[model samples]
Target chain A: MLKANNKVLVTISAIVLFFLIAPLIMVIITAFGTDATIAFPIHGFTLHWFANVFAQPDFVAGFKMSLIIALAASLLALVIGVPLVYALTRYNVHHQAWFQTLFLSPTFIPEIVIGFALYQGLVITVQLPLLLTLLIGHFLLCLPYVVRLVTASMVLMDEHIEEAAWVYGSSRLKAFLTVTIPNIRASLVAAFMLCFINSFNNIPISLFLNGPDLSMLPTAILNYLQNNYDPTVSAISVLLMLFTAAMMLLVEKGLGLKALNEM
Target chain B: MKNRSAFLLLLPGVLAICLFLFFPLLQTIWPTLGGSGYSHFLHSGYNRNVLGRTLLIAVITTALALGLGLPLALWIARQKASVKSLLSVVILFPILTNAVVRNFTWIIILGKDGVLNKVLLGLHLTQHPVTLLYTNAAIVIGSVYLFLPIMVTSLIGSVDELNIEVEEAAAVLGAKPWTTLTKVIIPQLTTGILTGSILVFAGAMTAYTTPQLLGGNRHLVMSTLIYQQAMTLGDWNQASVVAVVLIIMTVIVMGLMRLVTRWLDRRPANA
Candidate 1:
């Protein structure tokens, strides 16, 4: 009976994995197809589609914009998030739970709602620039993960060491810089990369905030795919997936997989 | 001294949250109530339809995601380490891919002369290509495809943490496989299921692109309604009203989720 159950489980696993992986494989296959239209079972193979992806001006501009926005947003999130994480985890603030919830609520709300709300509030009421709006949206979106990871790391660290540093001669700022920052460096790096990936891949907010000239890569690809159907989008997607995977591997190597799992 | 530094450290995040996050949330509520009147915005027939459709799609997408994602997550949970890692990567591909790219891929796949219909016609599977795009079904399919990974990942987190010995012990004590699974494993997985379901529902509720692309002009989810009002109609008040309604609904659902999870957490230890 156990053997039969194990076999059934293995078969189920294989089927699920196959279904999940097949689309990506199909995407890669379609990318290399010599035919203009994307179709299964390629007649010939070529790298012209990938070449096209590079040649497209919109794609190039969008890629650069997405990189800049993602970097800026993640950096801003880290700057705000790291200190917030420190305060929440170390200090006994009044209404700490409320503060935590307030900070983390962005993750709980729907991205679409947040996007729309921010658009209405910023574009309509505040007249914020599109770039600034995008920055604000991405920063809010990525803040929760950074705070959660950093706070978790802080909670795991021994607080006595910080207290000892304070008792010895270091000022609170000096102690935090010398002790807490170094202790949670792994979590901070992980938070930065995670926030970067999320900000980079984010679509809902970008869709709302993307202007004519300031289109992010995802929005550009979206618009392109809407008007045109070809393997160029697939090629771009393949590149994105590989890039993210490479980053994940790098993060794993630097921080350890255990830290990521905790995140 | 410690308190001062802590406050200083927290000031940036707090200020950002207030100015960008909470302030906008509060501002979203006013137009819904303040524009004309609460009843005027609330009773707007067009807004009602948008809200209804948004809720329906959210609920439907959540159900579908749970249906497809649960089985896959369970299957994944039982996989060997090497196989699980590979499968994890595959499952996360849709997530890592730009949402615009994925949704557009669906547009191509489900379009009038797209791959699926073309294949069906080529194989003589049907007399003519069935119209698959620009429909609720297509929206549901695309949204499920988009959000399934979130559900699967959350469920996997819950399932992986569960102790398997209870199921094994139940099996050894003359319980059938189905009986053990239904009675033992699933109850323990409820928290994970709830978390995944809530996340999926939230994603579906706020989904703009999938429905916009796939549902076309026929269907209007809340996000699209807001877009239409603000951008197309140039009615910021109406748009803000819709946006406010979306925010309120999301908050209510999330609050309910928390209540349910808290109840579950407080349940008798053995159960």
Candidate 2:
């Protein structure tokens, strides 16, 4: 009876796991379909849709914009987050929990709320330019990831090493630069991956914050999807999956999948 | 001096978050405080329907995710290390991919002449290609799919910490497996269940792409309603009211979950 129960559990799990991946697998398979509109049991295979995805100006531009925004947002987040996390972990700051909560608050707030809030505050009220507003939105989204991952790594490392470096006549900056940073390198990479992916794949923020001239990749794909129901979207999705897979490999090499699980 | 130094370190990031994030959040909530927006929202049957549907979908999504996620967590927890990592990679794929890309695939699978209808017709299960996409059920499926990773990841940690001996002890003490699951194993999983439910609930409630793509314009959830009000209708006041409603819903759910988890935690001690 116990063994039978185990079998049942395994079967249920397999089905659930399949459900998680089935959409992605379908997207990959349909990318090569010769049909004008996407359908199953594809009549013939072709690389035609792959080339067709590039023919669209909006997608190419959106891809470029998304790359720039993700890169800038992740890099800026790291610069601000590393120092903030280091201090929070290392210092005797008052209301440290409040500060930590403030920094990490973005993760808890729904993205639509954050996006709409920023749109109202920045775009409407402050009158910031669209690109700057977009940058700010993406940066807010990225900050929580950096704080969580880096803090986890920093908390685990021995503070004594940095203190020891200080005792050996090293400046605070020098000790932090050499001793503290090298220890948390894995997490930095992991944090960057998380930040980059979140910013890149984000929809709500892009949806609210973007102007007519500005478009993120996901939003552009959404625009395309609204008008067209073709295999070109499947092609774009397959490329995105491949891009994510490459990033996953890089993270695995740099940090490992364990760091991702912790997130 | 230490505090001063810490403040200096925090200054840049804090200023950015406060000026941009928190300030905007306040702005989003500020209008609703004036009473007009809430009165307008409360008066509108359409607005109330969207709010009701969002909450209902969120609840159903959380429950379904827990049902599906608990078993997957247990299965993954019992796997070998290498196999565990492999499964983790597979699970992580959806979490990492673009939401639009992910939802788009569902559009393909659930479309009129899509994979699902085709299969159903081929098997003589249906006489016609049923409209599956842009329905309430499709939104639920997509929401559960979008947030299941969060649910599974949260539960896996709790499941790993669960002692197998406890369940065995219950079984040996004249309890059936079902009783052990409900009484022993489930109690142990309270933390995971609470955390997972809250995350999944918040995610499903605020989700835009899944509902926008799968539910389409006809089936509007709060998130999509906010989009329509703000972007399409260009009414920031109405949008902010909806946004505030969403924030309140999430906060209440989270607070209630914490209380329930606490009650569950203390139940055995009381007994």
Candidate 3:
């Protein structure tokens, strides 16, 4: 009976894992298919679609813009989030839980809501530029991850190490810079990568904030998919999956995948 | 001195969040303050259907994710260290992949002449290709696929926490597998189940891209309705109303999640 139960468990696990990976494998397979339209048993194989993806002006422009926005947004999130994490984790501030909740509240809300909220508040009411609003949207989207990952790292670090630096006549800022910063470097890198990828891959926020002049990579891909049904998107999807997989490797090396479950 | 430094340290990030996050949320809810948008939304039958459909889909996605996630989590929790990390990566792939890229694959696989139909035709399961894309079922499938990783990751912790000896003892007592599962395994997993359900439900409720790409315009969820009203028809009033409704749904789910976390803290003596 136990053996039979184990077999059932293994079977279910196999099926679920296959379900998770099947779409990704399909995209990868279709990327190399020579046929214009995706079909069963795929026709001849070729790499022309990859070339087509790079040749498209929108994809190129959107990729550059996505890089800029993601870098700026993740950096800003790190700058703003680091101080918040330090204070909350190190100090016994009043209403600390409430403050943490407020800081992390953005993650709980839907990105669609955040996107529309920023649209109404910044673009419509405050009259911010589309690019500025897009940055703010992405920054808000990345902030919680920065705060969460960095906080987890800081919490696990020995607080005494920073105090020891301070006790040795180093000033608070000096100790934080020389001691605390070095301790959390791996997690900071991990957090930045996580934030960068999230901002770059974001769709709803970019969808709402992007104007005709400014297009994000994900939304641009979305637009292309809407108008065209060729394997070029399949090629692009394969490329993105590869990029994200590389980022995941970086994150794993930096902060171990177990840390991601800190939430 | 400590208090002052803490406050100083927190000021910049707090101010940024207040200005960017809270302020915009206030703006979103601002237009609906007159209550006209609420009345307008409530009066429309189509709006009601969208709301109902959104809830229905969320519930279905949550149930499906839990059904699948429990076994996967259990299996992974029991695996050797080397195999566990590999399985973790496999599960994390969907979560880390770009949303557009992930949904694009579903679009192909579910299309009329797509892979699923191809296999079904090959196996003679159906006479002809059936319309699988752009339906409520597609939305549910896409969402479950999208969010199942989260459910599995969350549940693995609780599965790890379960004492193996108890299960061994139950089996030693000649209890049937089903009996051991119901009597021993499930009660301990209640918190995990609740948390996973809340996360998956919230995800499915607010998912814009999956439902947008898979369900198409014919089927409208609240998130898509907000996009359509605000962007397509230029109806900010109606869009704000739907956005506010989504925020409320999120808040309620998040509040439940908070309660679950608090419960986890307060109760440490789980056998």
- Which candidate comes out best when scored by DockQ? 3
1 or 2, which is superior by DockQ?
2
Local lDDT at B236 for model 3: 91
Q: Per-residue lDDT tens digits of candidate 1, residues A57-84?
A: 8999988988998999999988888888
Q: What is the DockQ of each candidate?
A: 0.53, 0.66, 0.70
Alpha-carbon local distance difference test for all models: 0.80, 0.88, 0.88
Error in Å for residue A19 of model 1: 3.2
Show how many residue pairs clash in every candidate, following the order shown: 0, 0, 0
lDDT, candidate 1, at B120: 94
**Least well predicted 10-residue stretch by lDDT in candidate 2 chain A:** A1-10
> Model 2: per-residue lDDT, tens digit, B1-271?
7778888899999999889888888877876786788988989998889888998999999999999998888889888888888988888888998898888878888899888998999999999999999999999999998999999999989988977877777777888756776788777787898888988988898888999999989899999999999879998888888888888887787678768877777886435
DockQ of 2: 0.66
Clashing pairs in 3: none
Cα error of candidate 2 at position B129, Å:
2.2
Candidate 1 ranges with C-alpha deviation above 4 Å: A1-12, A261-263, B36-47
State residue B29's C-alpha deviation in candidate 1, in Å.
Answer: 3.1
lDDT per residue for candidate 1 within B1-271, as digits (tens), equals 7788789989998899889887887777765663474477668886678778788888898997887777678777777898778677677656766676566666667878777898999899988878899888888878988888888888889888877778778878988766766788788889989988987898789888788888887788888887787778887777776776677788888898989999998999787
In candidate 3 the C-alpha lDDT for residue A149 amounts to 83
TM-score of chain A of each: 0.95, 0.96, 0.93
